[model samples]
Target: MNNEQIMNLIQEISEVQAAGNYVSFTCNNFGIEVFVMRGEIKKSKEWDRTFFFRKMFSEKRTEEMYQECLEYLNKMKETV
Candidate 1:
């Protein structure tokens, strides 16, 4: 999907996240349900600041799907 469409999806996910719940949606191209949950990453010794977390899930997880999810996350970060 294009950047605008991707951004829209990210926004929708963020809205659901803000409400303290997980959101699931099917990817039109992959026909797989993508689940998203929001939380915070614990601070580590190497990184003092705790980073925001966007946990993603799929029934048949693969590298390509992971990359796609990362793409969405990067886009979301950019918008933020």
Candidate 2:
């Protein structure tokens, strides 16, 4: 999963293409979000920024969000 895969996943989520420093995908119900910020995952225990999160009504535990994160994170780690 490269940038292309991540970008495609983001599009699948129906995320709003808003202007911001970070690209965000939010699940309001679960209060979870996966975003790309400063070329890294936006949520890390070492460094986290969730100020822009908005609630999502979609039921989780589906392949949707997991695939997105897995692809993004896996590609990011591999590139490192």
Candidate 3:
């Protein structure tokens, strides 16, 4: 997906996370699961760093997404 699409997905995840809920979605060969645990947002590691990930998602984009998630997760944590 392009950066805009990825940002949209990130926004959706953030919304669900802020609401204290969980969401999972798959896009082409990529997928993500987001939820809260111990009052912090968390992402599932079910498909992280796997062969499929390397084949489907560019390392740069994947890291970008991860960093964005971390930023949002930390932002949420601070508000609690």
Candidate 4:
């Protein structure tokens, strides 16, 4: 996606989160699942709004969570 499209997607995700909703998408090719949720960090007792991306096929996954998250959203947009 182009920069504008990417920014729009990011804005949409942020808006959804701000409205107390969870955002999730999946990438079939990589069997990756991405989730963005609002919560708190127990250790710091701070708000910890974040994204959790995981490879569905394996218990052990790589450190490419960011890439997987983007690819999942792109795939979702294509489907929509």
Give the least accurate 10-residue stretch of model 4, judged by summed lDDT: 40-49
Stronger candidate by lDDT (3 vs 4): 3
Best-to-worst order by TM-score is 3, 2, 1, 4
Worst 10 residues of 3 by lDDT: 46-55
| Pairs clashing within candidate 4 | none
Report residue 55 deviation for candidate 1 (angstroms). Answer: 22
Cα error, candidate 4, residue 63 (Å) = 28
Provide TM-scores for the models: 0.32, 0.34, 0.38, 0.32
- Candidate 4 C-alpha lDDT tens digits along 29-54: 44434465443213445332334433
RMSD of each: 12.2, 11.9, 11.0, 10.6
Which residue pairs show backbone clashes in model 1?
A: none
Worst 10 residues of 2 by lDDT: 45-54
Q: Mind giving the per-residue lDDT tens digits that candidate 1 earns over 1-80?
A: 44564566567567645655444555554333455444432333232111221224333444455456656554544443
Identify the superior model by TM-score, candidate 2 or candidate 3.
3
lDDT of 2 at 17: 26
Better of 2 and 4 by lDDT: 4
lDDT string, candidate 2, 11-51, tens digits: 63333223222445654444546655434333463322222
